[model samples]
Target: MKYDPIDSQLFIKNRKNFAKYMQPSSLAIFNSNDIYPTGADSTLPFAQHRDIFYLSGVDQEESVLVIFPDCPKEKHREVLFLKETNEHIAVWEGEKLTKEKAFETSGIKTVYWLKDMEKVLFELMTQCDTVYLNTNEHYRASVETETREARFAKKLKDKYPAHSVAKSNPILQRLRSVKDPIELEIMQQACDITEKAFRRILQFTKPGVWEYNLEAEFMHEFLNNRSKGFAYTPIIASGNNANVLHYIENNQQCKAGDLILIDAGAEYANYSSDMSRTIPVSGKFTDRQKEVYNAVNRVKNEATKMLIPGAYWEQYHVEVGKLMTSELLGLGLLDKADVQNENPDWPAYKKYFMHGTSHHIGLDTHDYGLLHEPMQANQVFTVEPGIYIPDEGFGIRLEDDVVIQESGEPFNLMRNIPIETEEIEEIMN
Candidate 1:
């Protein structure tokens, strides 16, 4: 991998915590994501499954992890099955992980070749009464294609019909949602890289520049800082395109006096840092543009303070809605009449700020956490608030990743990334 090696103690603790949640005699399984195909004889970039990567630090394809904590033999308690490397394969695809390297990458001492999976699993089945199968139960998932993990689950179930099967998603959903100290440090590193990229763009962006050129600039800085490009597909929306929440065309030219909304973050060591900043195309915001930008910035700051422990996701958004309502009132976007007669389902503030203000941020841009449960400390989230008016010909959004605090307000991870109107203006100048 291009990224530096993460401490294996994190994976060791993760596996231990997951095993604690498992039922006695249950063997948990996790599989790496397949290298997805794009076209004939070509494939898109290989990305590791977040679940498998969390359990074992093995960031390669065609790998598997099994944790039989209650196994009869001690060595079989935690095992890693990797794609074995040979002379010809090494010459063609470079050297894969050696057994000694695997031990270092993951804390598991017992390792085997992928060819021995069936034989070893057959033995494990006889020794265990229950099995924990991994599944994609993420709230935002809409998986249609059968993944390698799903297929392996089917084979395991068919082979051992007598064993009681359980789902590993519930345990992992909670575990991965809460950030470990090490994970948060890595995320902070990613955010620092993203900050550098944004600062670089602040000096580079000007009128008549193509959106893709900005994208290129961000990627150049991200790679230079040991990141694997963006955490997600970047949205470099300019002009009316900013009204589209998921706009990623990046084909338009940044016109003078227009605003460009860049929703981007760098992925460092599989940890993601999400950030969104809307800046003036001509290195200066017009009076009216600054008014709208200031409104969004105010709302973002207020919303981030609400991401404290014990705040529920749904209720937190309601509080943010009230905050946005007050900002819109100050900006003259909503009048007294609009506030009094607004529907509770769709508040008057939503007329200007439509999408959600915040979401969990970590491994994925929209990371995993139990939304129904109350927010907790160490949980990271993106506080992004925007106001889009296509007729107005521009939009403004200010975002920062924050960590919920145990005592007081949440801490901004992107605190160094310039957000204040004056700061941004000064940087552009």
Candidate 2:
């Protein structure tokens, strides 16, 4: 991990909150994610499961965390199972977490090697009547590969068929949705790194630069700042490519007078910062491009204000759609007659601004949150609104990560990153 060690108090508080919601006589378990294999003797980078990282701050594979507040033995109530390390293993794969180090990292005193998991779990299973299991239930999740958590959950259920099973996803969804103060600080750092990368790109962008060249520039800035590169795949969409919402083929040459929409961010200590900014390849936006850019910026600003407490996720998007509708009408993309004849399900504004305006952002780019529930304070979200015009051969999008506060407007994390047309132009020139 390139990032500094986090205060374990954050994990301690998170575990306490998780325990408060567990059923009496129930034990909850969280497992680390698998180091997925890419080919023979090679693997993709290890990414810790967010649940275990959230609860224990154990950012390693082949690890397990058990929380049993009702246990008769206090030491056994919270235990960590980590892969055993030895002199030979240390030489080959580096030092795995020692029992002592695990305690320091997780704040849990009782730690065991992975080999002893079954022996320890058997005793706990007999004492607890119910077991809480973690599962992926994020609204946008479409997982097909069976995760380590799912495999362990199947093993637990097979062995302990009589124990009552409960889902931990709902509890986690609500808990992880609201950010703690420490979490906010880390997320802010991620956004700060993203801002640094964005500023670097503003000066580097110009006509004849390859899209991939810009991508390399972002990665260089991110790694130099101690980040593990982009939180998600970067979209360095130039010209008509911006019309494709998920464009990532950053291979074309940026022509003069064309616009490039960069949807990229940096990941710090497993936290994600999402940002999208459109800029002119020629270092100055044309009259028509500036108009659309300003309109998108205006809509982004207005949508951010609606992210306060008690706001409904579905209704919030509807309100944002109205704002976009008005902007599109003013842009001449939609007429008054188009609004009147538009379908209720697919509004007239869909022609230009098709995607949702905001979504919860955190550890995962699309973080966990129940859309049906009302928004709450401390919840971080991305306010992104874009206008795609294939006929005009350019698109515009502006986005910022913001935190919803108790009162007043939400706080913008990207406030320092340049957004104003004059500001961007000034910096570029």
Candidate 3:
């Protein structure tokens, strides 16, 4: 892990909150994600399951956590199972977490080698009448591959058929959605790293530069700042590619008059910061480009203010759609008749701004949050609004992460990052 060790208190407090919500005499288990395969021997980098990391801060593969607050033995109440490390194993695959180190990282005293999982689980199952299991229940999740946690769930259910099963997603969705102070700090670190990368690209992005070069600049700054890299796939779309939404080809050379839409963020300590900014490849926006850029910026600013505690996701889009519609009208991209004749199901504004205005941003780039529920304080979200016009040869988007406050306005985490056209121009000059 390139990131520094996090304060385990966050994990400790998270476990306490989750434990409080568990059913009486119930045990909850979380397993680490599998190191997926690319081909023979080669594998994709392992990403720790967010739920387990949220509770224990264990960022490694082949790990398990069990939380049973109702257990008779105090030590056995919270336990960690890690892959065993020895001299031979250390030489080949590097040192896995030792029992002592796992205790320090997770704040859970009872730790065991993976080989002893069955014996310890058998003991824990005897004391608990119910078991809490995790699943990919995020609103946007479309997990086709069976995860390690999914396999374990199947195994546990078949082995202990009599135990009552419960879904852990409900408790986690609410708990993880609201950012604690400690978590906010980690996310701030990620945002700071992303700022460095963005500032670097401001001067480096010029005519004839490949989009991949811009991606490289971000990665360099991220690694220098102790980040593993992008929180998600980095999008460095140039010109008409920007209108395609989710364009990650990044192979085209930026033209002098073209605009580049960069949707990227750095991952620090497994917490994420998502940001999107569209800038001119020539270090200056044309008259028409600047017009659309500021329009998108205005929409992004107005959309963020609506992230109050009671705001509903579905209704929030309705409000944002109105704002975007006005902007599109002002740009002459949509006529008044377009609005009047638009289908209620697909608003006229969506022709330019199709996606949602904001989404919860945290441990995952698109973090887990129920869209049906009202918003709450301390919940972090990204307010991104874009206007894509392929005919105009430019698309503009502006985004920032902010925290919903209890009384007043939401606090912008990217306030220090250069955003204003004047500020960005000055930095590039």
Those runs of model 1 whose alpha carbons end farther than 4 Å from true positions after fitting are none
Model 2 clash pairs? none
How close is every model to the real structure, measured as TM-score? 0.98, 0.99, 0.98
lDDT of 1 by residue, 16-118 (tens): 9999999988898899999999889889888999988999999998999999999999999999999999999899988899889999999999999999988
lDDT of candidate model 3 versus the reference:
0.92
Q: RMSDs, each prediction? A: 1.0, 0.7, 0.9
Error of 1 at 167 (Å): 1.0
Q: Which of the two, 2 or 3, has more lDDT?
A: 2
Tens digit per residue, CA lDDT, model 3, 201-294 = 9989889999999999999999999999999998899999999889988999999888899999999999898989988888888889888888
Candidate 3 — which pairs collide? none
lDDT score at residue 171, model 3, on the 0-100 scale? 95
Worst 10 residues of 3 by lDDT: 420-429
Pairs in clash, predicted candidate 1: none
For model 2 the TM-score comes to 0.99
Name the best candidate (by TM-score).
2
lDDT by candidate, in order shown: 0.92, 0.94, 0.92
